[model samples]
Target chain A: MAETKTYREALREAMVQEMERDENVILMGEDIGVYGGTHLITDGLIDDWGPKRVMDTPISENGFTGAAVGMAMMGMRPIVEMMTWNFSFLAADQIIQHAAKLRYFSGGQVQIPLVIRGPNGGGVQLSAQHTHSLENFYGHFPGLKVVAPVTPNDVKGMMITAVRDPNPVIFLEAGALYGTKGEVEDGDNAVPFGKARIACEGDDVTLIAYGRQVNLCLRVADTLEEEDGVSAEVIDLRSIRPFDEDAIVASVEKTHRAVAVQEQWRWFGVASEVAAIIQDRAFDYLDAPVERVSGAEVPAPYARNLELAAFPSDKQVANAARRVLYMEEK
Target chain B: MPAENGNGENGGAEARGEGSVATSADRLVDLYREMVTIRRFEEACQRGFRQGKIGGYLHVYTGQEAVAVGFLDSFKEGDRVITAYRDHPHALLLGSDPKNVMAELYGRGSGIVKGKGGSMHLFDVERGMMGGYGIVGGHIPIGVGIAYALKYHETENICQLFLGDGAMSQGAFHEAANLAGLWGKDGQCPCLFIVENNQYGMGTSVERTTAMTDLAAKFDAYGIEHEKVDGMDIEAVLEAAERLTEQVRETGKPYAVEALTYRTAPHGAADFFEKYRSKEEIEEWRQRDPIGILENKLLDSDAADEEKLEEIKGEAKELIDEAVKFADESEQPPIEELYTDVYSGEDEYTGEA
Candidate 1:
């Protein structure tokens, strides 16, 4: 019973407590039942789940996300949304060939447990066709899980493990942190998926990030320990396709330097798979080559200082955490 | 809001001259032995893709076996079926197991997707046959989201889906026919779609793709309810799949039929030299051969002869030669099943950290 809530009211109280403890969940998209979700986070949820479990579809994002992957291949736990992950590139072939390869081409006999969700990167301007970070385009698919939570208690505990994970998740969220806020934790809080939290800890340099670039890497790890005494740390990832990567190689083996950050755009981003998983398993505990930052390969600009120079900033993640801590250079 | 269709012109030659005038004689000899076991399991998947034992691309549903045996013999038992990628006669007419659809076209490990969806994906989904889709109007919004999950599980079950005719100029089939015409305006879309119109998409036809080639009047611009049968007539596609699956299970809505039909091979099996189309328009649709018009309607009603359709084509070539010796003694999956079902719960959700 801790309250606070606002990442769009904890993503609408995690779809109103999983649509009141599942009657096989539901909630389709496109003006999410009576104009409540163009980011109103499913507003008054079709007046408490009516229109047949709050459906309201028709802008046909690949026909209601391929009819929420045919109502999640018959067992129904739907929850589609996609009002923007830049219009989910019009249902990217029913989310990469039928909600991520229909249970390995149906040998596992189907279980899409679909989630989808919406709002992805590029702050406000909404220029390049309603911006999009797409966590490395849905964690470069392979059945898909891809979380990206960022707070308000990890989007209501990872929207209850992407509505009880059977498969297809993607989630993302963060249209400029829907009125930010934080605290959350109420009931049946569910978060598990590939873990990664350590949002503030510190060492000489860790950083990393996730949706809303983990509050700009916790405000650039609090201005690099209050203006350059330098502690850093941060982390936040919160699932990018089952990516805890042992909490990012144990935070670059306890901050022997790393940076990452995102918003999306530095060539194949999610900060280039967190700087190649911190140089593939804390390469001799990194100390240097792991920098990243991202988001300005163009296309998200409609002015306002060219969409604040296309994004990524707290002075470019404090200059990539002062060039991975060696105090600036490479 | 378009619904009221009717202009399906000659509605598939008036449902192939009045739907086989009350057919019987043992369900037209079990629909001419399941359309000669899908033309002998797609001519043994074109000799197992010319003996390399089939791997990847092999579309062939050859002249679309009476639109997958007249709408999977009018579905019903927990109705469901989906298609695209000329799926080996919609998984040998929706019951799969022809040695697991020839060991999922010889990829093996008792195939039927255990061979992880080979020839343009193939699934069984416990006999509801919910897959085949190798993109092309990608499973038409997954058959309007499996008829919106069989009307969200209250089930009077329904979902036909199949695609082709270049997936009716895909925008994922006009956004799954406008959300099965807006969730069938509250009957919660039961879905049917079908289309098939085999006119050619790979070698581009349907009058070079669409100036409104009336693919059942494009589901009357998405208000759904459409028609147009005669897919080389298997009793006018089982009397329009028993009157559109009993009017989509009594009004759960979402229909559309189309059929028309023509692909007598060459959209795969490495599309032979047959440039676009010709050879007398593929010998005039091989004289409307839906198994030679049901063996000339079972010898004009003697109810089958020519040595009983040559002993039902010698028991469909000895059940496709024991499904090609049970897919040449099955088993190939190994390599630790290349990391099982992608991700459904631990195997460390794959991408091995």
Candidate 2:
């Protein structure tokens, strides 16, 4: 009865299960139906669910996005997908202004349980137009719960939870990990927002990240433990908006040194915000300067080599760790 | 008027009552009066802004009065309304104390939003007047999102979201629209998207900014039922809104209404109207001004004498004068109040030093 699956498959299962359980759940995006998604994340879904539920849209961001807000306002749990996080910028008004302000402005009269899910970050050499990390953009908003699930398990769990939660949730999945395979839990299980997961625990230094970067951090942790005898505690930030800073502070209390890592650039980036929070909350607990490991501050290039160099890698994380642990020259 | 017209009925055309109940001339006259009051109020506000009495970015919605008044007439006391920064008319139409609204423009503490938000950022949560947003097309999703909550609460209420043609171009409009369309087809969405297409988005005209000349046609993509209405004509706007809003309230489906109006003033007060539009164009729209049209209707019907119409105008002037006095006398919002209402600090324990 059981079968092995990819991370995207697990997410599909979560959506399928949630949709089946609740008639109110629906999905909408470009090419989500007949096109089966630009990635196979929604493959076979349209065939199973049909057009009414697995709705594809015309190339009109303002119209459909506003319609989604209207739907969420009406009470159906709609999961809206932008093909990429870059496309979401087109609908930023609906996301930030409308979805975020309705509840407070209505004085707690409504909840927009709408989820905008899509691939975020760069590595596929899609170049500047498609590649973007909107974690900070959405994370800056108040009425939204911004989620970045790295694992197949969390992707399933958090998405289901986001669909069921009372507020609007921005479910960000990394493009590079869509087809990546891993073990995942079965039916109906959901992860709560604002809660971080410890992918692999260690005590030497804390490695903080989320989405696809968490796996990269874990790989670096493995490299550090095997080669340099440095055990890195890897933390998945998960929900970026209501961030799980408690877990980060608790880990930093034990590890003393921290390296904030992300696929986005270092300047005024998501990781910088994290580093600031860590410094403010656990300033005295720091054994050294709160170091940051992020991508170079440049537009993501289309070529494979430049694309790889533009984003943070496991080796760069190791180098950051070496610098933090005083194992090598900066 | 047909009950099943536009998006007024639930359960297809069959699951509902007839489209609209005809109204007596008294009710129509009252609506006309409300529109007139809004016209005179904005004209005075403009004069005040120029005279240095009101210090803020005042967005006078001179031509788009009918959209708010006509749409809001369908809403019961408990129903909600939210819009972008050009919100004075909406506040006036939504039964807010006009004095408080005018005072808010004067930066008086007693004003709506407690004078924290000036012309472009008025908020009166008590009246379900969510706010006047400063960001272009920023408040659309939030308005629809709140509508989601209202329906969840099981209240047979509808939330009306009014935005400009400019906001219709934002991606959130599409995202929120897709959501509304899908949820609406299932009969769970109680949102009404009223695009007050006042011809321009600041400096750009709709023809320049968007591909679609008729914004109502934009709804066909989302599969939501909608149309374009003459915003200057109060009767037509009200007739259309009454039908559409009731459908949303009764069936829990969403509707879109594009009230095609033109702004007689500059997008905001700062720009000269001559830069984008011709003075003749403004003159033409002014001749068909909602107030003038209503006044003519009252004269034709003999609902009230010309003297009574003048008295109502005087009454509106007195109200504004009271508001100006109240705002002048009332102190500005104390600086310490800034930290308040930023968030619901109740459950959050930040452990601040």
Tens digit of lDDT per residue, candidate 2, span B87-133? 98888877778878887788776777676667877666566776777
Isolated chain A TM-score, each model: 0.35, 0.96
DockQ of 1: 0.30
A122-173, model 1: which lDDT tens digit per residue? Answer: 7688788788788887788899888888788888889887898888888888
The alpha-carbon lDDT assigned to residue A277 of candidate 2 equals 83
* lDDT per residue as tens, model 2, A132-245: 888887887776778999888888999998888777788899778888887787776678777899889999899999878898898998899889889999999998877787
Model number with the top lDDT: 1
True contacts kept of each: 0.79, 0.25
Which portions of model 2 show Cα errors greater than 4 Å? A1-5, A20-22, A46-50, A101-110, A125-128, A180-189, A278-287, A328-330, B1-25, B47-56, B63-84, B97-118, B121-266, B274-287, B318-353
